[model samples]
Target: MTEPVVIGSERSEVGLPAAMEILLSGGSALDAVETALRRCEDNLEDHYVGTGGLPNARGEVELDASIMIGSSRAFGAVAALKGYPNPISVARAVLEKLPQHALLVGEGAAFFAQECGFATADLLTDEARRLWREALGPSVESVEGENTAAGAGDEAYRAASLELVRRLAPHDGPWGTINVLALDRSGELVVGVSTSGYPYKYPGRVGDSAIAGAGNYCDLRYGGAACTGRGELSMRAIGARAVVERLALGDDPESACAAMLTDAATLPDEFRAELRTLALTFDGRHGGAAGQVGSVYALMTATSAEPEFRARRVV
Candidate 1:
């Protein structure tokens, strides 16, 4: 059996420690990853994940999340989900109760959440509303607290599309999503990822976070990888699975992540943004890499009290 450990993306202060608690108690990796990610999904201060996350063009909190089990390679994901809290839990339910489906989107994902007993709640906090209104000024006022993407004129969405392009341009760093990967005493590895997606993205746009083998991927033999920034790049490259495949081919965690980012570099610059990856080898060794400078990841072990932060190796 491998020594239990947990690793997370940035802003996982509360998440990593909580996940470590689960591992220390001999919990399964699936439960630990879900618990840690749920903590992040509830963090209002962290606008990149669950509640309080940045809104889309229609000013709605459309959450995306996925959970993957390594040993069985079974995973479930939901994209464009709204009015529900803790999308990671919903994704897990899809894996457990609806094994035939691996992905659900839009109203379908929300319906599944409802069937599983997850009550619909307003995900847009006051702070998020302020940010949306401030970003789009009068464009989003009519749509506040409601989604009219289907009936609204293109005039409203036009502004958001332009703003989205501007935001995608080169910048200091763009951060979104929360990732948690855990290895338990039973040698199981699990990966969980959740995000509100690109700020002010066109309504209904799904990023890499909800795409298994892109944003989150794992195998009991090859380990797992989770993505952070620039979901577009990750999706184009199938980022997470690419890294783990390198590990299966004999690359160490650091080398595997570096190689994966190197391939991502081939993608066109028009949509490229800083892409970071968090990885763990099957034996529980952890490492990460970033397409931009100054990006970081976090890690914790069963014996540690807090997660240690590390700058990801730049591609």
Candidate 2:
């Protein structure tokens, strides 16, 4: 049997080493993928996810995550969850414990995590809070061509803050996420994703990170795929699923990802420039692509001693 391999989104270096350790020790693909995502989720230095996530306009942190086991086509997801730092683990629990359902959202997801004994914590960090405050300052919004301040005790300011968040949130700008894919020696594939969603988003807003076909998709017969960047664009394009479907149609992993990225480039400029994807085949072949120039992904194989950061071919 061939050794296992793992691939991840641009920042996966943060967790890829640990994931490779588990794979080298003969862990299951699902286990390795989950462990890697958990590491990223706990990393306080990463403001895009978990403990250091940026808050919503209301100054509350909400998280989204998903996991998929290719062999069984089983999926689990949580959206708009508050106080849970490791939503990837919560998603795995939802997959294992809740056989009939694939997704949970909001308070229901939080309640489910509590039932599963997941630890809860405030996900917002000081740095993220400071950024949120800065984004909501007096210059945040303009109404009727008049600059409005988001200062305290001002109704216009409050409305301006909300509008600013609405426009800039939900996968705009330089937001980030983690997408990890693993192929075990036994040929089983598992893909997982975790994100804080768009920084300073509205409360209760859920992005593609928690959606199965949008942010992630896997099939042992074909491969697996996961996406980052603008969640709305991915959701609209069915980004990850499109890549896997192309692989299913006999395209190599690289071609599959590049083709999807090319398609993404045709979207409106806002969504097009920020799109990115990573893919892995059942046989351990992997690749990535982006709609904008200079994007990259991380790769780790059984033959490699460390993860390699490779630049993506922009479409």
What is the Cα-based TM-score of model 2? Answer: 0.91
Q: Write the per-residue lDDT of candidate 1 for residues 1-315, one digit (tens) a residue.
A: 679989888887668888888888889889999999889989887777888888776678899999999999999999999998899999999999999999999999999998999977789999888876776666555554565455546664665667664664321233578889999998999999999888877789999999988999999888999988788889999999999999999988878999989999898977666788888977989899986677788889877878888888988
TM-score of each: 0.92, 0.91
Clashing pairs in 2: none
lDDT for residue 282 in candidate 1, whole number 0-100:
73
Q: Pick the candidate with the highest TM-score.
A: 1
RMSD of 2: 4.5
Q: Report lDDT (Cα) of residue 101, candidate 1.
A: 96
lDDT of 2 by residue, 162-274 (tens): 77765664333445889999988777899999999888877888888999988999999899999998888888889999999999999988799988877766677542337
**lDDT of the structure predicted as candidate 2:** 0.85
